[model samples]
Target chain A: MNPAVPTWAGVAASAALVLLAVAVAWHGRLRLARDIAIAATRAGVQLAAVGAVLLLVFQHTGLVGASGWLALMVLVAGQVAARRARGLPRALPIATAAIAAGAAATLGALLALGVIAAQARVVIPVGGMVVSGAMQATALVLIRLRDEARTARPAIEARLSLGLPATDAFAPYLRTTLRTALIPAVDSTKTVGLISLPGAMTGLILAGVDPFTAIRYQIVVMYMLLAAAALASLTAGRLAEHALFDDAHRLRPLTTEPRRERV
Target chain B: MAPDELFALDQVTVRRGRAVLLDEVTCRLSAGVCTALMGPSGAGKSTLLRLLNRLEEPTAGQVRLHGRPLADGDVLALRRRVGLVGQQPVLLTDHVPDELRVGRPDLAEGQARTLLEQVGLPAAMLTRQTAGLSGGEAQRLCLARALAVGPEVLLLDEPTSALDAASAKAVEQTVRRLVAAGLTVILASHNIAQARRIADEVLVLRAGRPVAHGAAADIDYLKEES
Candidate 1:
């Protein structure tokens, strides 16, 4: 049986469901109705733009153009992640290096092993997935590491007073932050088939691929995400740990103002 | 400044933006002496203690150890020799023994027990969880952990401020014993009685400047503050 291609009518129907949800939220006095509406519209526009761009690159680009596109994705991801980790010195460079290294290493290995075809069609999508996963993990690790270091100042200073190096003093907090950062990816992998079908597998199956083939692709994607997230979190944590302290090994006082308390 | 001074601050000043936390204060701490920094709240007593280990840097002038500038040496090595116990106890691990051994993992269990005994805690408390410890017990545990580094100088910042009267006495006695063991101590205390009881000399601070520095009995400024 041939897979049915989604037409403009199908897209409109999906959007109508979002409008209905927004109406329900508005009736319940949920202030999030506006946010829901705006987010749905934004997601639709962004996805359409991405789809067009990917088609152009897949049809016309060689390896050089594909790599350039992948680099652009990584750059944008790094900027977003760095903004989330605002107030950290050198956060942008740190996030960029970590995400790039993680995505490059994982994609390089997959390509070298001949597990995935070395074409723009496979590399761009797979590389985009790896980069986004690392971006998320890096952002969480940076933010958590900074927050933990600030709140745990007394403990860190106590350790430093006993002659422990900054790296050794921050070991426990780093471990906690890395674990927190990677748990999301780990959990999704664990619950993939049981809780819900992931996007890759569902997409492949809907595109007329056999179920077993989709499952195999989904498994590889899950493992690759875990590897990328782990590497990203660890690298980001290590770099952020140094930023928390000064050359004298003293905790640098956080310059950012405390977040306003929610009423 | 005496040639035998262990620590000497010459016109040391610390500024946080526009406000000066510590003004141009000069003092000398002689070797093997217990010098108490007596001040009211926010008078820079804790800031002065922090300077000894380079936890906080002075904005102006200099702090010298053994007649050499503190900035001249490796800070980690300097902190190892000059240990600090903060106003509140902070432990990294759940168990008392692990907290004690955190700084010195090579420390033997028996040696840790001996340190606990010196701090007036029972050796059996070593196995107890740090979360279950009383405030005083936690403070003493911090002290024991500081001692694990074998520091030549110890800085205590309101070490007994959170303790009950009896707990305060235990900590005070432990500190006295450490001083007698030839460990130089710089203690920051708001309690005049505690300072009088333990200090050989007193440096009185008011609004970040030293108003008096002399023998504890001779310094009448503390009496006025009281």
Candidate 2:
């Protein structure tokens, strides 16, 4: 083990730290505080459930089981993303494309480059991380794009009247808005070493990995995140633009549908 | 449903959390004519205009365009056919003329210049930042944007209420020209004199209800009541 974490107690302490987070979440009285508490409790249950499933999958090594596990991850991620985007375009397809693309590319690269064998242990965590990152990027991009689309409605209508196609009409605003969404990933990648060390690289170093190997892994992960975020943002942005326009190239009215009143 | 009747609100009523914003309001707006919706600040004139374009759906009534229900029709097509210009003149672009032609980024810059010119703005404003535009320039730009869509019906909510006399006159002249070009105009304004100068028909609204509706030239009684 590396000098930073030479014993198993460090991992144990990390696990215990989650309890403090739960306590803090519960003690707070804000609107989202209860939600945070619920989310933390749910996360604990989910992690345990996932661990039980993974324990069986690792031992069996069957294709059906492995694919099923991945599918569950994708489905859960997509559903969460869609719920976050309450009214914007269909979030499932965007999340699916983003997660599939990001996971496949990153996992494939890691295996081909011989970073680790195509074993269950290495593949599952790394794939999950890539998918999760892509999901976050997709959500941010979709929300930002939707808001920008509304803000740019007048400009869009102006172009439509000027005889432009729906796609062509939203291109200018869409371009800038999508670019803005990708900035976080870009800045994180650019300033990785000079500003702050990334979590994965630091964890690996603490776990006794060689400095050079850790750095290479970090570099690859950073590039993968960039690729994933850019692809996801672009896909989600285009999807949003299409969803908001009609066949005759007119902008659709935004909905303000009231929540169903319970008797 | 006449070709001339570009927009018509038929027994439209709007409620906000159980409070009536507009109640059973009926009005017909025609082509090649300016109709001023004269009312106090809180009257439903702006809300009524929003209903005409399906910007806000009515709680219990329907708006019609060409004799068909506004809700039943495609919203995008309707909005494209009817353009809106508000008091604030929200120009959703930093690149001025370029942003104005967003969907058709390939559209010639000169076309945008022509639109600015038509709205009483100098062609030089084509390159200026939209944020830098004066209130009058911004208002004209909004009109230019509305006109850019080739809308048969135009909804103007206090188009000149925020401008100086010179700018107001310029905007009023543009409205007259638009009417002359066969575009339908529905304007909501507090300026009675400006209304008389520009409107062919006038509808007086009080407390979200229409009290009087008729030709603008027959407004002597309305003036007496004021």
Candidate 3:
């Protein structure tokens, strides 16, 4: 079955599956019928638009066009991550920069080493994965850092009043924040094939690629995500550490920001 | 600029939103002076002490150190010279010695031992973990940690309110000894008797206003003037 372009019959079957999910939620009284229906509708519409755009992009695939697409992905991801740490100084720019750096570093290494091609088709899919992984890591790091700064105020202030520089006082908490952000990525990588065939490998196999070759690509993707996550966490954590302090070497009082709802 | 003055708060006012944390406070403390800040909770005792080291800057006023406004001096250097010991025993590191060696990474065991001894903690405490310490022991450790930086002036907030009688006495004696050696100390305490024992001068606040400033012996000499 060609998963990329589904037949009318195939589309109907998928639509039925969505209805089943909605029905199940309604039966269980999970109060998620509207949520499930809304999510499915959004996914369907978004994927359709992306598919059409990708077709045009692949037709005129060039270095410039591919780069533009990647930039857009990073910008969107950064904005999403920034929302997780809204009250922080330069939150939007910092989030975008960290995610971009992580994705670029990982993808650059992969292309240079001949693990992935530089074509728009190859770069976009793999780059999307890399960017998404980095965004998750960065958002988690920022949120955790803010929380730790609040909870550990007394401990940090003690160090500050003892004449320790802001960087030195905040160093331990930064390490803890990075560790918390990286753990999920590391755990997923560790349990990859043991738990289940991952998304990339499963898609490749279902699309008629050799299972062995698909596994090889999936392995590279796993390593790519790990590298991206670590890079993003490091960049975001250090930038955040600097943001937390004032020129007077005192911790800036972090004001609470309202939570925003996203579609 | 009085030659004897160590700290001068000139028309200082600190406001948090609509709440006044400190209101038009103006005072002077001489070098080698041990001044106790006494008042009930929310009396701005801690807020007044924080100004000595710029832990909390006043919104509308000036805090001068050695005739030089704190705003003009190198803040990092100023902090090194003016240390602080918070009301709570805050030990950042898991072990006792690491907490003392926060900024002074190269501090030797002998130096750590001396600081612990000065704060009435045993030398063995230097090698011990901070997790096992009692409230009084932790308080002394915090004192030793502050002294590790060799500050010229120390700000202590409710320092001995949590300690036992003997431990409190030892801490009070340390404050007196340090003052005798020419260091200035500003302590925030609710205990009137403690203030009388160690403070050479006392500043009593009521709801963020300095109601009285005089000799420690005259702690009971305050009369509310309408």
Q: Which candidate is the best by DockQ?
A: 1
Model 2: which residue pairs collide? A161-B149, A168-B103, A169-B103
**lDDT tens digits, residue span A1-263, model 1:** 23256788788878988989899999999988998999999999999998998898888886777899989988999998888877777789889988998899899999999989999989998998999999999999988877787789899999999999899988989988899999999999989999999888998988888999999999999999999999888888878877778899998878775353232
Residue runs of model 1 more than 4 Å from their true location after superposition? A1-3, A258-263, B1-3
In TM-score terms, which candidate is top? 1
Q: After superposition, how far is residue B59 of candidate 2 from its true place, in Å?
A: 7.9
Give the proportion of true interface contacts each model preserves, from 0 to 1. Answer: 0.85, 0.20, 0.67
lDDT of each: 0.90, 0.75, 0.87
**Candidate with more favorable, higher DockQ: 1 or 2:** 1
Q: What is the TM-score of chain A alone in each candidate?
A: 0.92, 0.78, 0.94
Residues B35-149, model 1: lDDT tens digits = 9999889899999999999999999989999999999999999999999999887878999888888889999999999999988899999779999988888998999999998
Query: Which structure among the candidates has the greatest lDDT?
Result: 1
Tell me the tens digit of each residue's lDDT in model 3 across A1-263.
66656796898688898999999999999999999999999988899899888888888866677889999999999999999887777789889999998999999999999988879998999999999999999999988888888889888888888777888888899988899999999999999999988989998987888999999999999999999999999999988888888888888877765366363
What candidate 3 gets wrong by more than 4 Å, as runs, is: A1-6, A112-114, A257-263, B17-19, B162-170, B219-226
lDDT digits (tens) for residues A81-130 of candidate 2: 65555566565776666666666666677779887567776667666777
Mark the 10 consecutive residues where model 2 chain A has the least summed lDDT: A254-263
